[model samples]
Target: MKKKFPIIETDRLILREVLKEDSADMFLYLSDKEVMKHMGLEPFQTQKETLDEIGWYQTIFKEATGIRWGITHKENGRVIGSCGFFNTHPEHSRAEIGYELSKEYWGKGIASEALEAIIHYGFQHFQLERVEALVEPANSASLKLLEKNGFKQEGLLRHYEFTCGKFDDLYIYSILKGDVVTT
Candidate 1:
């Protein structure tokens, strides 16, 4: 059988891999300035930039270390966002997790659902000992989501990323295997 994503369903959403057909939907959300703010991106003014991102997702399966998941609504079947882990440190059996949701889907619990599912999948399928998420300090919602999902705030990495013309500090959070509530 072909390898399959966990394909989690939590009442309102389904989390799965990003597909070629999802380009337009991904572009729509990625192009929104407000949605793209915290996410490290200067809105895609050209369709090619959007296509490149989708293409990058499509090529993800060729790797053994990283995986990405698309978040779609179960009721309308629209892809509202994505979540996944990447930049794995094989020796330490750890990786960084990241996520982004469309503006329309904000304030809902979709981001948390997608994150929990992906974290579970990582431990279930990989030899991972821990998963880390680096969030911009200003993204309060993201900080809350990681906390609710059993991650603990580690500290800030000053000047972690230079995005949209300014240096941003990344607030690091980590969830280890079998953490009180993570497993």
Candidate 2:
């Protein structure tokens, strides 16, 4: 059986496993057309879509391969974003991570804090060999955040994702276990 992942906390946010109760909170970000603009994700039109996502999370947790975290504000106790390592390769000991936050909460460093906490958890508990992140080039803030958090830009993949009704290049960024230990 897979071990349960512990919840991670930062000064301003609590990164915990996503629960079905979080659908409404998640909709706050997923519903915003602009939030998904550069992300290649289309705006989720209904609650059922949110429920479907929740169902997927259940499978995700069971596999214990890709640990998912819902980002909630420490002060308000509101779920404002989701950030976690997904597409896990346990044998390879690596994972790809992704995150999305409500526009209302952008620019406050919450994403950065949450990301650091999750990355730390991935390393400490999973013995992750490496963690990778892919961001759309147009989303400068995300790209910048990854860079700020010690992820080095590995390369740009042509038409890496089909998001928001368009095919776009994705900038790959990564930090290895060895790099984390040294830095």
Candidate 3:
């Protein structure tokens, strides 16, 4: 079953549903080449592209296929990034997790806080048995973050994704329901 969209709050951020108004903010980072380097996403060139992406994210929620949260700063209330679970398989009780933060927000612990809340929500609300993440082999920060959250490296997928005009290797990590211990 699809978990309803909920406004997840933490000490410094709020994970909420994306909005059309967020397109401009999304464009800020999504347009940066450095930010899109690891992921296979192209740097968006126009507000139209960001708007279209936002529309797609909304559609994902409406279709009950997946849930993506716009990570917003509580004090400023601007979306700094996004995180969510996709490729959900109700029968298997599993989902793939993905996330990205603006370069300015990197190393701020913002992603960790937001991720913890969402992971907790996934387990408690969706009753998921396992949650997985696919990260670029060189994405050290992400690897560390997943490890901090108890996700174990399962294996490597060679040439698994074509991103930034090249095939990229991905490291698979997973955490089971029984392994979750919310901090």
Q: Which candidate leads in TM-score?
A: 3
lDDT values, one for every candidate = 0.82, 0.83, 0.89
Give candidate 3 regions above 4 Å deviation: 1-4
Q: Give the range where candidate 1 is weakest over 10 consecutive residues by summed lDDT.
A: 56-65
Q: Which candidate would rank higher by lDDT, 1 or 2?
A: 2
User: What are the per-residue Cα lDDT tens digits for candidate 1 across 12-108?
Assistant: 7888777777878888888888888888889888778877886666566556567777899998787888888788887999999988999888888
Q: Which ten residues in a row have the lowest lDDT in candidate 2?
A: 174-183
Candidate 3 similarity to native, TM-score: 0.94
Q: How accurate locally is residue 124 in candidate 2, as Cα lDDT from 0 to 100?
A: 80
What TM-scores do the predictions have?
0.90, 0.92, 0.94
Q: Which digits, one per residue and each the tens of the lDDT, describe model 3 over residues 73-131?
A: 98899988999988988899999999999999998899899888889999988788999
Name the candidate, 1 or 2, with the larger TM-score value: 2
* Candidate number that wins on lDDT, 2 or 3: 3
**Residue 110 C-alpha lDDT in model 2:** 85
Give the Å error, residue 6, model 3.
Answer: 1.2
How many Å off is the CA of 100 in candidate 1? 0.5
Model 3 weakest lDDT span, ten residues long: 1-10
State how far residue 131 of model 1 sits from its true place (Å). Answer: 0.8
